[model samples]
Target: MMTEPAQNTIIEQHINLDDVADLNDTNPLELLVQATGLSKQRVKDAMTKGAVWLSHGKQARPLRRKNARLRLGEELHLYYNEQVLSETVAKPELIADEGDYSVWNKPNGVWSQGSKWGDHCSISRLVEEHFDYNRQTYVVHRLDKAARGLLILAHNKEAAAALSAMFAKRTVEKHYLAWVNGQFPHDSITIDKPIDNKPAKSIVTLKEYDADKDRSLLSVQILTGRKHQIRIHLSSLGFPIIGDRLHGEPTQSQDLQLMAYKLDFQCPITGDKKAYQLKTWT
Candidate 1:
């Protein structure tokens, strides 16, 4: 049976998963202490008990498993007893390019942007630091910090506007890899769903199968961008991605086997189609 923490001692905050980037690099226990004004031991105990909700991984245990080490560009949800707190941290290697756009391989656990207080480190800040002198960078789109993948950054307003338009028009093609719970149906399947007042399409291809675990590795191609579209759609299809705490069962592992492995689009500046592929796991 579960027991609740002290009512008066309980702390909670509904943090946007994207804002977690700010807390990267800092000790998770330390962050919790700072946020809740609690003792280090208290924070550590909660963490050891798996009270932390990470953006891309399973709920964490109180024990500081080495795998539980937080990284930049990741978001975290923390609860002390029953109180919740959230934070985002930035990546150290984020960069931007002169073509008006830059690409980043965002690891799971960070936020693309954040709220005030400059409390969380986010991809926007990571790019802002790279272009701090100009302060003109913009996020063309976002990747869930817990979902590792390729992210494109706009260096200037023009580039940002153009890329935003492209996404709105559904002209970009995005591909991802996910490790889902259960044997996938076939070689391929397409998910056509309306997402947030927009049309969303996804093509899933089976890549590998683990018979012992009854899980399938899939390559997901998205014809339209939507918040949690693939994760939600796949979960709706009864194959929720593993380690996805929000839409799937909680696992012992800390990493979600989902990666934005590929992206294809026409450059607004070059007027030519360009494709970027990243195989972080394959």
Candidate 2:
């Protein structure tokens, strides 16, 4: 029987070349192939997945193309991680396209940020691809990769700044829905806990209870956005959301049960009230 490779087992290396003859080579693919002694298809696949890089002096960026000419004296780097690059990215649903800014239903496991290996699975990168890369993409806020639901991506700088300011000023109303492991109190409760020495608040209201599963469906509105505020607050109360491996107990559902179900706020660019919610919930 064959065995699957562990996720931690990976090849990560930076190849540097300075010889005069090696520097004169213009083809990045040929240079990487000869230098690393890897197959052409493997090298090409690495480049396309953003595992290749070009660096000079202090500046460095990903090099994501094959058959591209390389500049003399510039350094070539390859970060080959078969585990990271091979994982599939979940698809996000575009809820509304407001031109300057758009709303999306980000699925669980979809990242809000990109990594050195690549951002092919990130919502920010996905939004850029949605517009065919004509408009610049800006990230105003983020949702946890394990939690799914509503997110906004600003298409331009002005919109990005304005929307970010709204979050900073706490004008954006963010609501979350979670299925927790235990039964919660019938009365709504407000948790005013200090997270990381900063004041954070979350108001949780019970919507339904499953007698069979002994779990509760909760509606959580966070007044202060801290890192994992909702998850931390609920877990602190001993009603950890199901599948929250980081702070809560493991459950049957492998995916995180928490979700940013709704976003309500005044549109900064249009001065219109905007409310977006997911059509379906689990």
Candidate 3:
């Protein structure tokens, strides 16, 4: 028996199977119920939404299967985010509807995909809830939670594979609009820096400069998709993005001044060039 989790609780903990029970082989759901004191249904729901992970030694992987049997000394880690637990939900604005793939303008404060507890606060879960439960949604790429802009989601695995390959091959072009602190010297400058030991390149073109306010607007195009590449590259160059707390001084607004403005790629299913842009944030 289990009630609902409190709205403000965020759980991230690892529990070992050996510490909980003496059983040789037991399912993760049973262990989770014992570990978190959550109901069986609550544990099951968390696993289904990708809130759990299995770790043994140095190997850790997402635990999606509810009935997965645990080995001795293996740890079941639970991650529950409280932000999505709020009743408020952000809806994505549909930009285009291709048969195989769909483009949406994911709003700020919304996750591209859901976590264990934040499934309802994500675009991928919303698509599945509104469209068809039987239909599968695959995330081709991810957008920062604080950034608002154009995004694409694949409906099927085949389309997902092809679209993911497009990104991997660097055949896709992404354009972003960023608001930075201080005035940039060059109207056109390229930042070639290595992020996480991988080569990352970004071309920053000064779009609008407000010297009086010490603010600058830039049009950035990233040649490589590295984690926090744009923000890291710009911060290293002295002009940190305004409102970015992770890489720069935090602003009062707290809203990151970054937007995925445009995306260009060829439709893998139709063999036609496709380009999508959102003028809302620009």
Best by lDDT: 2
User: Which residue segments of model 1 deviate by more than 4 Å?
Assistant: 1-98, 131-135, 196-198, 250-253
The candidate 3 region of ten consecutive residues with least summed lDDT is 80-89
lDDT of 3 at 168: 87
- Per-residue CA lDDT of candidate 2, range 85-141, in tens? 777777888899999998999999898987778677788878888788787778899
RMSD of each: 12.4, 3.5, 5.2
Candidate 3 lDDT by residue in tens digits, 56-145: 999876687877877887888988664544435678888888868888888787788775454667888777766666567889998998
Better of 2 and 3 by lDDT: 2
Number of clashes recorded per candidate: 37, 0, 0
Local distance difference test scores for all models: 0.69, 0.83, 0.81
- The residue-by-residue lDDT of candidate 1 on 1-282, one tens digit each, is 324345446565334435565544665665556566666766665554446555545443223442356654455566444322334354634423546788877767767764322213567656666666376558888888678878888877888899999987878888899998788887998889888778888899999999998889999988877788888889889988887888887653757778887878888787988887774573
lDDT of 2 at 82: 74
lDDT of 1 at 166: 90
Compared with the true structure, the alpha-carbon lDDT of candidate 2 equals: 0.83
Q: Give the candidate order by descending lDDT.
A: 2, 3, 1
